[model samples]
Target: MSLKFHRDKLSPLNIWPGFVDALTALVMVLVFVVLVFVIAQYILGTELNGRNKAVDELNQEMNRLSALLMRAKQDINQLDAEKTQLSEQVVTFEETIESLQSQNMTLSTKIESLTSDKANAAKAKMSLEEKMAYLQSQIQELMSQLKLKAIAIDQHKSNNQVLEEEVASLTKKLKSALNSEAIKLANYKSEFFGRLKEALADQTDIIVVGDRFMFQSEVLFDSASAELEDNGKEQLKILAQTLKKISKSIPADLNWILRVDGHTDKRPIHTKQFNSNWELSAARAISVVNFLAQQGIPTKRLAAAGFGEFQPLDTTDQDGDYNRNRRIELRIDQR
Candidate 1:
């Protein structure tokens, strides 16, 4: 069958050809569009697969960033804790500074008290020094008075020593004057005896011995009698005148005495006028003193003594010695 014949039976014969040509053209256009869509879909799928691989790599980077953010948060928390501790230390330092300022005020008050005590002590020391100066002046005055007393005592001792020396000088002068007077008296006695010896030189019955003139008792008196004979009285007158002449030449200050001593022989005698030789001898001495007084001789210058047989001139018991023992002696001496 022909195409035109199949078309006539289905459609009107006049429009069938145009419609068939249009439908065929439409189917060719649909087939070309479908082919272009399939090629576009394959190219899009290949690009999608590359984009998926890049997305997986981005997810792994985001996970790493999240872990780093968690660690940064922990560090911020530790920094906050340290800032709190530093704030507490600053408050404690402020309290310590306030306590030190209070102690400085207390020490300042103690130093002011010490300064006041030092001023009071200086005033007391000055007052004590003034009192010591007054006491030293009083001690100096007492020492001056003691020195004046010592000088007065020394002067008194010097005067007493001078008076003692003057008294000793006067006593020595008196002793020297007495010794000169005694020597002059002795010279006068020696001159008087020498004159008596020259006057009686030719008379054998009269002899001079030492400082005395000795005469035999028989020449002056009778044996065993007290009376002076005539010749004895004449001889005594001559002796009295001689002594008177010599005494006038002597110094009046020299008071001299003529001593008459009568001695007897060793013989016992008993007579009516005498009991023994001692009485006879005494009477003979007294007779001679009385005769001299009558011859113008001073009685004050005459003295008499008597000696019996005890005054013998010769110790042998013989007649010649007995005659010599019986004698009268005159001596001149100081009264």
Candidate 2:
């Protein structure tokens, strides 16, 4: 039996030892592969850590950029607000300029109107001055004429007194011839008036009223003055020459007189020279008598009288009537 078992083990089907050796070799190879895989894993972990650090740095840079953008937007908004306020101020300035222009135009028109009115007033004043000058000239002309009439009368009165004495002596011698002489004297008086009228025919201011020669006061005298002017002296000289011729032809016994009567308007006078209209009229008549005496007229043949504000040719209360009421008259009458 022992010999049969030993022979079975030694047979070719006894592969147990060889199988254990192969299994041991396969286990060693698996160990080597596990070591290689552990080394590769360690290298991959190190590379991943470096990539994570780079990503964190990139995220911080992006946040900083976003903060800068927000600041830029805020600045833009502030600028827009300021621009709107400036535009409103510019509009206000334009309105003020327009109002000032309107006011300037209104002032210009007012100045032009005032200038026109001033020119018109100046023209009116010039015209008034011209009219006043004309009126003054007229008054001066009237004044010169009045003075001559007054002077002529006084000269005649002095010559008449000498003639009166001669006539009285002649009358006593011609008593029987008185009636015929009276008739002759009456005829002579008419002839003398006709001759006097002829001598003064060219004078329109002297008017024959009844038996008297009437003259406007203004034609013979200045206002409130008895002084004779050059023109008045010339006129009185002519009258004195004519009267001397008439007196030589007349008979001295007739006792003829040339009555010089002065009249004044109702208007009263109170001046340094004259106290009233009565004094003015009386002075004018006396002035005439004095002038006639100076001209070699007979004093006895001249008579002076004054009527103050009593008799007037014109009755109405008018400026022209007042002028007409003032008069002077020459009349031939018995002394």
- The prediction achieving the highest lDDT against the true structure is 1
Candidate 1 lDDT, tens digit per residue, 1-335?
69989887897448888999999999999999999999987887787566556545555544554454445444445444444443444344344434433443443444455676555544443443443344345444434544443444344344434534443444444445446556776677777777766777778999888878888999999999989999888778778978888887665555688999989998899999999888888889999999999988889989888887778889898898999999999998776
Candidate 2, residues 1-335: lDDT per residue as tens digits? 99999998887876889999999999999999999988866776566556455444445544454454445445445545544554455455456445544544554555566786656645554554555455456445534544443343344344444445444544444443446556766676676667778877887767788777776777668888877656666666677777888887775446788788888998889999999888888788777778888999989888998887887888899998998778777777764
All candidates: CA RMSD (Å): 93.0, 75.4
Residue pairs with clashing backbones, model 1? none
Q: Report the error of model 1 at residue 236, Å.
A: 1.4
Pick by TM-score: which candidate is best? 1
Candidate 2 Cα misplacement greater than 4 A, ranges: 1-182
Question: What is each predicted model's overall lDDT from 0 to 1?
Answer: 0.72, 0.68
Give the distance in Å from residue 92's predicted Cα in candidate 2 to where it truly belongs. 99
lDDT assessment of candidate 2 = 0.68
The clash numbers for all candidates, in the given order, read 0, 33
